[model samples]
Target: MEGNNDTVVTEFILLGLSHHPRAQAMLFGVFLVVYLVTLLGNGLMVVLIFVSPLLHNPMYFFLSNLSFLDIFYTTSSVPQMLVNCFSHQPTISFEGCIAQMYVGLFLGIAECFLLAVMAYDRLAAVCSPLHYTLIMSKRLCIQLATISWAAALLLTLIAVVLQPTRFCGHNVINHFSCELQAFLKIACSDTSLNDLLIMTNSIFVLIIPFCFILVTYGRISLAVMRIQSAKGRSKAFSTCGSHIVVVTVFYGSAMSMYLHPQGKISSDRGKMISLFYGAVTPMLNPLIYSLRNKDVKGAFWRLLGKKVSE
Candidate 1:
């Protein structure tokens, strides 16, 4: 990265969420807890789904994929965020910043697609109960998960390859991490192309998948209403309620941050939004599913009982 006035830009100073030492200490404790919970919660979900025969269906298959994604997704930035909270002047190497930016992008986009896939899985279970097993077979589940991950990889690669090589101005990033929008704000060179790429990527990774989820739930609602049994309708809604909450938090924050027109971004607002989606949402995902989902609770106790007996 070229620096202004012949100074080579080697790293960036992160102006983290708070400048006050007291506030930083408080935030450190808060985020440390959040990070640990994200890891343990999502990690347990993955292990439980893998080990429990009761969770071997397509729904839990997609869920396990989501669990893995949340684990990595939060890990990409939260560790650095925790470190920055204690540092008087937080800095990230140029290479490290770039790595954080793209890694988060990849995992975040994967979740967007994965959530859509989960919505489709719910539609099958509720709308086509008789054929749900046939429609969401093992092969189809693997293929869908593979495509979600592969597509995110390809999109992230394109964004990286097309990024402007010159970053000739300031090296101070005004956020906790090297967030995409915050990173873009620091580029001294013309970033019209980069801005365009972000918009296009947002459409594919955020907009389209969100729309798909909405339509899928629309179909799901109609199917549930058609069921004559109140018990059946209640069951159908229970199956989708957790997913609906997760999608709203994740996609709503992401779209607000990424889809806004250039120059409309507020520094403070962006940081808060990033914190919610990046840290808060990942931690909430496993909790939401486990609390709302009876099968997950059942499998957990069953595993606990087996270990206790052993």
Candidate 2:
């Protein structure tokens, strides 16, 4: 309970993205736009998929889940970061920080697994078109979705339960939000067990799922190459184009952040890396999926026409 000088640390001060008044103002505007776009974009995707029967299949089913995750992921942390941007002395109660850390970790891990499940769906659609529906039945889809969420919950609980309990040092977290790694730096208790747990969970939640995605995409590529008609090949590639982009952008920054050796990267650079996935990636998901796909556009037009006719 006692921190430095035998003081109890009850709150953590967040050194937000910037300290300069002008810079903080600019960051506030930028992140505010990003937060709003992330909400509207991901929110629209969920609603669009829900109403469009054309998007009722496994691909969009998974996409709708992804959209929901993106919404939750950004909402969990971005609002707090935005508030910290304007506060003269941005601080969060120790309990608030713990809650933020766990929620953010769970959503992030869930996305990692959900993306891998999506890759498998793509594999089925491309590699076995005739049996794609049979392979990705509603039951299997629900099971995969449930497992992704349940696994993330289990892993996050383990990390939190085994985390270093005592905080006997300074309570300044260098990052904007209560990031797990940033919070861990402020812990006064021994963190070897926590470190091991993070690494183990990262392997399951990041490295393994990412590798699975890569291999699944490789098989899809091979299957596409064997398609006899040019139109067929193009269509197959188009079906997966958005997912591939999302996976690359999400996993690239995430793996770089988690898998790389800790303490080797600078604090500011680490914040930038986190910002990409935490803010930028969620904003890009709906854009990437909608802009590149003909199905979503067609569904939008159809819905628009139905509304006008009514």
Candidate 3:
């Protein structure tokens, strides 16, 4: 059997969500529907924001970018998972696994920073209405978005490059896709450095932004309280309510999964919580924003009208 020195791992078996055939089929159906909704919802948001002239403000601009990132973030893992559900031999090459991990990490981190930037945009608009234009100019928005993407890419690159610890044990990943924690856990060599790096990155990427959002909202709340009319306060809170809900769900799930001691929680529970932030949250974002915001709804109608006219 040892012809030369070619010990190639052709593929890796993905120990997907379930082993039972019926369970796999059921799970596949559910994820297929979820994936479709995620695609359509995020896709529509991007298109509407892009084409609508009235939506050409800093807020909607950030929203469009968020939608785009959500699409990729969900797609990076969910489709692979859906495929694995039905595949008799659910496998991904080593290179493919690495690529998936990189994309997922990059987009997930980018979304965190982008959401924080969006909070700052809202704060400037609400707290300093008079100088909103001067403060959040198109150029400045572009700069902030650029920084978000650059930071995310840098973090992902470092993580991927440092993950050279050989996989000497079972090649089968327990989860559907190549998750960072799962991959690190299975490494044959010491992963203390990798763990430290991941923790450091998580602090800056997730914890810092979460704190920034909290402070920004606190200022916004004070500003809202100062408004003379109850209607004014209601309107201001309504404008922020959707973003607040999203921020809470995303950061709450993420922090619980990463910030705490993983040894305390069962592995299955951890995977389930990870699915909420990684898979479900992206699918829910556009629905929450569009359903709740009159501006976005109006833009949707306008876009629809233009399509009909065309």
Candidate 4:
């Protein structure tokens, strides 16, 4: 089904999670529950940050943005996955695919940058506590969040717009969602530039922020060690524990997904990893933050009390 240079692909089929009814049915239920919880968890984070004055600082500001991005990141894929599970034909139009790719890429990259910003915030809080307020000012936090969203969107937009996706003979995408790599696999045309761009962007997202996080955390760790009081050192480390846990979960999957050489990882592994970051991790983020950080727990209780009183 290879088309000539003049070939135009109007639609593409997605060979979703499984073909077996029982598998699909079971997956459908699981995905639906995860998607709902993702929305609820992230949505609640966003709302609580906005309404709770106690949580309106830079750390929570970046966190709310993360929650916001996670909401859309999961939304960009999981709904389609859920639909495809029940659908006789998991088909997406060319336009729909492009939209999905752009949204997913934007959010994915933004989250990377946002996490780096969070790392810097932690460094400031731990390594330079006296000036933490000035370092992660509300103004700076907003600027970082804005840059994360805008930079990711604009850069990805340039790539998607510059490279015209031409599907010659191949139109079957063997994934639940219109992932950029999966879409590229199905494009039956010259994709050298697109592949190069994906590689470059992926590398940038994977390397720069990750290096920064590691370095900042290293510095923070050193600073914590310098604290003479056991209680002081323990508190400082506690502040970072939740974020470190999150960073580990996120970067582990992201690195495996993006940094590996092309075609080395199986598509099945890719899908599972994608599900890990896209769906599962968002649900885990709030729980990690809440369970580990007493500030979050106290804030949650306070918010709940107000609601109960009302």
| lDDT string, candidate 1, 1-310, tens digits | 5544645778989998647789889889989999999999999999999999999999999999999999999999989989999898999998999999999999999999999999999988998899989999999999999999999999999989877566664788889898989988878778898889999999999999999999999999998999999998888898899999999999999999999976798888998899988999999999999987888999999999999999
Alpha carbon lDDT at 182, candidate 3: 70
Question: What does the lDDT read for residue 206 in candidate 2?
Answer: 86
**Residue 38 CA error for candidate 4 (Å)?**
1.2
Q: Candidate 2 at 154: error in angstroms?
A: 0.2
- Please report, in order, the local distance difference test score of every candidate based on alpha carbons: 0.91, 0.87, 0.85, 0.82
> Poorest 10 consecutive residues of model 1 by lDDT?
1-10
What tens digits encode model 4's per-residue C-alpha lDDT throughout 1-310?
2345545677878887657778899999999999888888888888888888888788898899889888888989888888889787789887898888788888888888989999999888887888989888878888888888888888888786755445665778878888777777766567777767777887778788888999999999999999999999888888788888888888889888877655667888887788877788887877777667777777778889998999
> Each candidate's TM vs. the true structure?
0.97, 0.96, 0.94, 0.94
Candidate 2, residues 1-310: lDDT per residue as tens digits? 6544655878999987557778888888988999999999899888889998889999999899999999989998999988988898899998898898899999999999999999999999999999999999999999999999999999988887787767765788999899887878778788777877777878988899999998999999999999999999999887788888888888888878887555656778888889887888899999998987888888888888988999
Off by over 4 Å in 1: 3-5
Off by over 4 Å in 3: 1-8, 261-265
Best by TM-score: 1
State the number of backbone clashes in model 2. Answer: 0
Over 1-310, each residue of candidate 3 has an lDDT whose tens digit, in order, gives 0114333444567777656789889888878888899899999999888888888999999989999999999889998999888887789988898889889989989989999999999899889989999999999999999999999999989997788446564477777788787766666666778878878988999999999999999999999999899987888888888899999999889888777543555666777787888888898899988897888899888878888999
Q: How well does model 3 score by local distance difference test?
A: 0.85
TM-score, candidate number 3: 0.94
